[model samples]
Each structure stands twice: as C-alpha cells, then as structure tokens.
Target: MSNIGSNPLIHFAAGATSATIACVSCQPMDLIKTRLQQSKQTKDAEKYSSVAQAARTIIQEDGITGLWRGSTSNVMRVVPGAGLYFLMLQMANRRYRARTGHAMTPLHALLTGSFARAATAVIANPAAVAKSRMESVGVWEYKNGRSAVIDVLKTSYTRGAMIQVLGDVIYSGISFAMVNTTSPFAQKKASPTSQFIVSAVAGAVGTAAAYPLDVVRTRVALSKAQGKDAGIVAVVREMLEEEGIAPLYRGVEFVALRRAITTAVTWSSYRAITAAVGRARR
Candidate 1:
C-alpha cells in the first residue's frame, strides 16, 4: 500500500485525471465567472447584472464557444496543478498520520495544504497566470493557448515575477486544503454512498473562501495584457486604487456555485484513484 503512494507516476496520473474530469464538468461556470470578473473591472460592466446575463452576453457577443473560452489553458494548468496538489496532499496526510497516530486535523490540513501548494507553486503559477488571462473578457486577444503561453513567458524576466505568480496559488492551496479537509470522507472513512455529499460540501466551502484570491489572480494575470507590470503587489495596489475592493469579489457567487460541484467531482475521483491504486498493489 505504501509502495503505491511512493510512486510519483501514480500521484501524477491521479491528479491529472481527476482534474481533467472536474474541469470538463464545470467549464461553463468557469467561463461565466471570468466574464463577470472582467465586466466588473471594465467601464461597461452594467450590461450584465447576473450570471444569466453574463452567459447570455458571452453567447451573444463572442458566440457559444466563447462560453468555453480559455478552457484549453484552464485544462493545461489544472491537470498538472491538481495532480501535484493531490499527490502532495496525500503524502502530507500519510506523514501526518505516521507522526500523530491519528488522522489529519484542521490545523494539519491548513499547514500541509499550504506547504504542498507552496512547493508546487513555482511550476503551477505560470499556468494559472495564463489560464486567468485567457479567461478574462477585455484582456488579451490570445489566438490560442500556445500564443498565450508564449506571450506570458515573454514577461518572465521581470523582477518579482515569482511573487506575482505565486501569491494567489498560495492562497488557493490553503483555502482548498482547509475546506477539503472538512469532508466527511477526508479521512477516507466514509461509505461509498456518503462520499459525494461530504466531499461536495467540503469543495464548496473551500472554493467560496478562496474566491477573492482567484479574482485577484485573474486581474494580476491581466496586468501584462493591459500594459502594466505583472507583479502581484503592484497589480493589487493598482486594482485597489483604480477599481476598489469590490472588483476582487466580482464573480464570487457563480464561482462558488460552479466550484462546489467541480471540487466534489475532483476530490471524489481522487479517492477512487487512490483506492484503485491501493487495491492493485494488494
């Protein structure tokens, strides 16, 4: 059983596969959330007052495919990020149990989850930056995922680049870990029937708490496209000065709703993968 967990390949596979499943299922909501964020920041935000307005506006203005805009970049980041996140989280849980003679507590979840993401943040941040930029409405005119990647990479040489990209990833990790830990099945103790409900609640809570950071992440990703420096502090300062705090929570309602379902799907799939891997070794 321990052997399966030790295999880096298994962790990667589990993370990527589960993330892909979750991303595909909740993509439309993600798209709408992006639109809402962009609208709030822009001068013409009044055109869309609700989630339905955002969706309809995207369909009407950018076509139906616009609703899935930036999905490629989203998958690109989420697959690897989710994979790394789960692998680290699982490893942390194992280590925690070994050290404490019991399962992880909220404190353990908070610390381990933060550490896992911080460790993976360097690799994951660039992808996150790209995903958010691609998702925003009035940002860049990225022709495709490759172009967006190339464009973002062009700015990597700037000072404080790491801090800029990592700020939100760190916040996201802490939020997800803390909320996900609350799952009734987080200790992997729930019966099959109850896993969904428990995991769903956990996912929703974490997603909602972490949403403000997501909004900041998206705006920071767009900084370069808007002809500004791509530092987290600088962008944040500018946002506060120009747009105010309200912009940071622009799409919270839709994001929380969508991610609740996505998180449930992701976490549940992760458990199934872990179970299968463990059973295979047995």
Candidate 2:
C-alpha cells in the first residue's frame, strides 16, 4: 500500500481510468445540469422548465446523441486533471504521513485536497470552459472539441476560471474530509462497497455546498464564450436581481445525482486499481 502511494504512475493511471469511467457514465446528467444552469425563467416562459423538459428538448433539437454533447471536451479536461490531482494527492498524503508518523487527519485531507484540486483546475480551466459551452443549449458554434478548446484559448477567460478553481478547491476539500475522516471506514481498510458509500455521501454533501458556485462558474464560462467578461460579483448580482435565488440552484438534482455517481465510481475503481497494482508488485 505504501509502495502504491509512492508510485506516481499508478496514481495517475488509476485516476485517469476512474475518471474516464465516471464521466462517461454521467455525461447525460452533466449536459442537463449545464442546460439547466444556463437557462432563465421569465414571467411567460422558461428555456427548460425542468430536468425532464431539458432532456426532452435536447433530444428533440439535437437528437438523443445531444445528451452527450460536451463529453469529448469533458474527457479532455477531466482525464488529465484527475490524473494530476491523484498524483498530487498521493505526494501530499505521503509527505504528511511521513512527517506525522500516521495517516492524514480530516484537516490534513482538507488542505491537501484543496491544494491538489486548485492546481489541477488552473491547468484544466480552458477545457472546462469549452465543455460548458459545448454543453450549453444554443447554436452549435464549434465544429468539434478541438475547435471549442481553441476558441476558449483565444479568449481572455480568467474570471470564470478563478471562480471555478475556488469552488472546486473547497468542494474537493470538503469531500476529502468527509471521506477520510476518523470514522469507522476511515479508521480501517475500507472495502469497495464502503468506498462507494463514503464517496457517495461525500459527493452529495460537497455538491450541495458548492452548487451555487457551480452555477456561477457555468454562467461565467458561457458568458465568456460569447465574448462577454463578467466578474463573479457581477454575475451573482445579476442572477439574483433578474432571476432570483432559485436560478442559482437550477440543476441541483441532476448535479447531486451525477456527483454521487461520479464520486462513488471514481473512488471505488481507483481503490480497486491501486490495490491490484500493489498486490501485483508484492
């Protein structure tokens, strides 16, 4: 186990594999969540009134395949991002354990998770911006994932990236603390089922806490894609004044469900892969 933790390749491989699986499984949910967040309700009409409506409209307008509109860009962002995150996490955890002569406490997990996620977000933000735009319900601007990414790279899209990094760092820290706390599962070797359960619980809690930030991030990303520069404060203020508070939680249900599924699958698969690699080396 210690050797596994020390192996950067193992961590990156496990993280990438797990992230690919998790993202593919929840891509449709992600598309819906983006659509819901990007939509606004007026006195007479709404772009997407509900999750079901969003799904139905997407299918009608873009075909059933539309449900996975941004999946390529999402994978481009998350695979390497998740790989780097796990590598950083393992390096941080190993150093912490060495200095303390014990496993990480919740506080340790929180700090390390925040640092790892923040660093990864900086590198992944452009791809993330592309993913959000590709998933948004509007004219399909880019021809492919590469074009979408190139378009984002050509713009000054820093505000949304800052907000996304902040929200993601906090979300990662909370989820890591929740999963690695001094609980029964944390105290002992967690089985795959236990890993899934703990990860699901952590994901749900983190998603709820960070969802408003997510909406803001999505708004800023899409706005930037359209050559608009809106700061976080301005975006939030506009949303509140024009759409009310409910819009901030537009796709909470879909996001919650997707996060739970993604976290559970990612952690369980990561653990299983690392454990297998450890045993193989032994």
Candidate 3:
C-alpha cells in the first residue's frame, strides 16, 4: 500500500479512470441539472415548474439521450479534472504522511484533495465552461448554435485561456477547500454508508460555494454561442440585471446532487482501484 503511494503514474491512471467512470455514471443527472439551472422562472414561471418535474419531462420528451445531451463534453471536462485532482491529492497526501510519519488524517485528506481539485480546475476550466454553455438551453436552439463549441475554442484562444483557467483555479480552490475540509470531519465518526452521506454533503457544499463562478463561466461561454464577446463580470452583471441573483445559481440543487454523486463515486472507485492495484502488485 505504501509502495503504491509512491507510484505517481499509477495514481494518475487510477484518478483518471475513476473520474471517467464517475462522470459517465452521473451524466444524465448532470444534464438535467444544467437544464434546470438554465431555466428562467422570471421569463416563464411554468418552464420547468420543479426540478423533479423537469427531469420527468426531459426523460419523456427527449428520452434517455436528452438527459445526457452534453455527455461528451461533460466526460471531457470531468476526466482531466478528476484525474489531476486525485493525482495531486495522492501526491500531497504522501508528502504529508512522510512529514508527519502518520497515516493521513481526515483533515489532511481534505486539504490535499482541495488543493488537487483546485489545480486540476485551473487546467480544465475553459473546457468546463464550454461544456456548461453547450449544455445550456437557448444556446443550442439557434441554427448557428451548433458552432458554439467551436466558437468557445476560438473565443478562449482569443481571450487567452489563461483568464478562464485562473477563474477556475480560484473557484475550484475555494470550493474544494470548503468541501474537503468539512468532508473529513463528517466522515470521522461515520460508518461506511455514513461516509457516503458525508461525502455527499461535502459535494453539495463545494458546488454551492463555486456555483456563482460557474454561472459566470456558463454565460461567458454562451455569449460566444450567441456570437457575442463578454467577460465574466459582464456576463454576471447581465444575468443579475436581466434575471436576478437567482439566475446565477439556476440549478444549484441539481449541481449539489451532481457533485454529491460524483464525489461518492470518485472516492469509492478510487479506494476500490487502489486496493485492486495494491493486490495485483503484491
């Protein structure tokens, strides 16, 4: 087990694999969540009515595929985020353990995880923004909307991916820190099932913390979809003025659920994979 801790490549592979699996597993819910978030109750109070009702309507109208509308982009965004998040976390944990000559405490785990997640988010933010925009409602309805993905890449290049990347770093850094910090505390006295509950709570906290930035990113990305250029502040202001603060956190509950499921799957799969790898090595 300790030897496995030293193998960076193995850890990276495990993290990437686990993240991919987690993303694929929860993609449908993620799509639904995004749609719900994008819905404007002010524009049409009857649009979705409720998240549960929205889910049912999407499933009925678009079938299973509707629930996974932007799955490809979602997977792309998640793979790197998850992979790097865990890789950084494991590496951080190893260093922390070596320094203290103790197994990772829950607090340590939280800090390491948060740091890793933040780092990954920096690298993966543009793609994440693009994915969120692609998953947004009106963006795809326009005839030129099909080009939104390409436009996102082009706009990102023009604006410098660095800016978007930095935003992601800050957003993920704070969000992960909060979640990771609290998660271990929750898990400390929990049973196995209770640990899952703790993780879910952590995920929800993280999502809520980062959601405002997510809204800004989505709007920025969607602006390109509409053949416009707008920075994060501009987009946020537009949303606030046009839709109110609620629009900034459109699908918060869904985001929470998505994060919770993703966190649970990520940790569970990571543990399983690490164990399997350790067994195989032995």
Candidate 4:
C-alpha cells in the first residue's frame, strides 16, 4: 500500500476529523478559559475568580449549554486550521526527507510546526476572534456563527490574529519538537496508549511555556470586539497596568489541561484513522 501520509486527502481528513472530535469534546474547557481571561477586563471583574466559579456562573446564567457557547465558531476555525496544519506538516516532512534522506530532526519539526501553525492562524483568525467574542461575558448578541464572523470582519481583528499567530507558532513548534524528541511513536512497535501519553505531556509543556500569549490573544480579540484598543502592545500594556503579570496567566491551568486533552485526542485519532485507511487500502 502507498504510504498514508503521501496522500493529502488522507492527511486533511484525519486532521479535520481529529480536530472536530477534540473541539467538540473539550469545548467547555475552552469556554471557561476564555471567560476567565476576559473576566478581568470585563465590568464584573470578580465574576469568575476560578475555574469552578466560572463554570458555575456560566451554568447559572446561560445554563449548561453556555459552557459551549463558542463551540461552533471554534469548530469552524479549528477543523480547517488543523487540516491545513497537518497537510503542511506532511508536505514539509516529505520535502525534508527527500532532500536529507533522514527523518525530521526536532529542530526541523519545530520550524515546520511553527510555519504550519502561523499559516493556519492567519487564515483562521477571523473565526477565532468570533469564537472569543462569543465566549466572553457580555457581547452575546450573535444569533449564529455567521453573524459573529460578520461582526468580526467589520472590526479591527488583524492585531489579535497577529498576536495569536505568535503564540500558536511558539506553542506548536515547541509541542511538535517535544513530541519528536520524546515520543515513542517513531517506533513501529509503540502502542497507541504511549503515543497518547507522550502527546499529552508534550502539549502540557508547550501550553505552560506559551500560555501568557494565549491570554493576551484572547484579551486583544475581546478588546477589539468591544471597540477598544486591540493592538498587541496596547493590550499588553493595559493588562500589565491593570492586573500586572498575574492576569496574563489567569487561566493557564485550564488551557494546559485542554491542550493536553486536545493534543492527545488529535494525534491518537489521526494515527488511528490513517492506519485504518492504510489497512483498507491493502
């Protein structure tokens, strides 16, 4: 059988499917993270002091469904974002192998993952901004995903996208590098459980390292949505002035948890799907 990663269609399908499953399953965590990050900037600054408090407030105010408020927007962005990222990764790795006759080194994996994530962030930023707006407290007038996108399109969304791209590139690069350096998945004999565990650990490490940028990205998007200054510098300045360094890591625990779960699911599902396709082809 042909190598599964040789086919762009398989890569996209596996990536998109894995993203969808991860997004749907872990959306509540995302929502809570967004809410926590935005809470400090909102009028009700004390509304969500912690994860449990945020979750309780969401359930009480908007029902349990509120925990997934931005899920559609998130899925819209992440599905295609993940697909393109994996496709880019496959193409990059193939080219590297063709030229070097060696598997990607960790450094090469880092560069490839950074490029893929930055490209995806640029393309998917509007949807990401919409997702943040939808998830934040207040500014809940969006009737559907389309309306949210339209609203974001009408605003100054590019700065937030730029900030997001920076964070994502770092996070993706580090996570991919860590996986290549530490994971057992390179061995044909490696079990799926080991792969999953490795991916999760790598993701948690990456998330911890780059998580402050994530908070800034969310705040920038929310600021723009609220017609405030959303420039990266401006958002950082405001955050520092108002809440100091602590606010930048407000929801790190939740995001690290979410990233671990999402990365584990994505990689595991992608491997399973591609393996299944390879088997079927044979």
Best by lDDT: 4
Q: Cα lDDT for residue 148, model 3?
A: 44
From the highest TM-score down, the ranking of the candidates is: 4, 2, 1, 3
- State which candidate has the highest TM-score: 4
lDDT of each: 0.68, 0.81, 0.64, 0.83
Q: Any idea what lDDT model 3 has? A: 0.64
Which of candidates 1 and 2 reaches a greater TM-score? 2
Per-residue lDDT, model 4, residue 56, is: 89
Off by over 4 Å in 2: 1-5, 41-47, 157-159, 182-190, 224-227
Clash list (residue pairs), candidate 4: none
Pull out the clashing pairs in model 1.
15-83
On residues 1-282, what C-alpha lDDT tens digit does candidate 4 reach at each position? 115748898899888998899998999998888878886666765778889888888999999887888888988898889999888888887888889997788888999889999999998999998888788876557887778888788865575877889899999999988876665444455677788888899899889988998888888777744567657898889888878999877778888989999998988888788888989988
TM-score of 2: 0.92
Q: Please give the lDDT score at residue 227 for candidate 2.
A: 52
Q: Residue-wise lDDT of candidate 1 within 180-252, one digit each (tens)?
A: 5555443456465466666566556666666666666666556655566656777678778887898777767
lDDT of 1 at 247: 75
What's the C-alpha lDDT at position 2 in model 1? 27
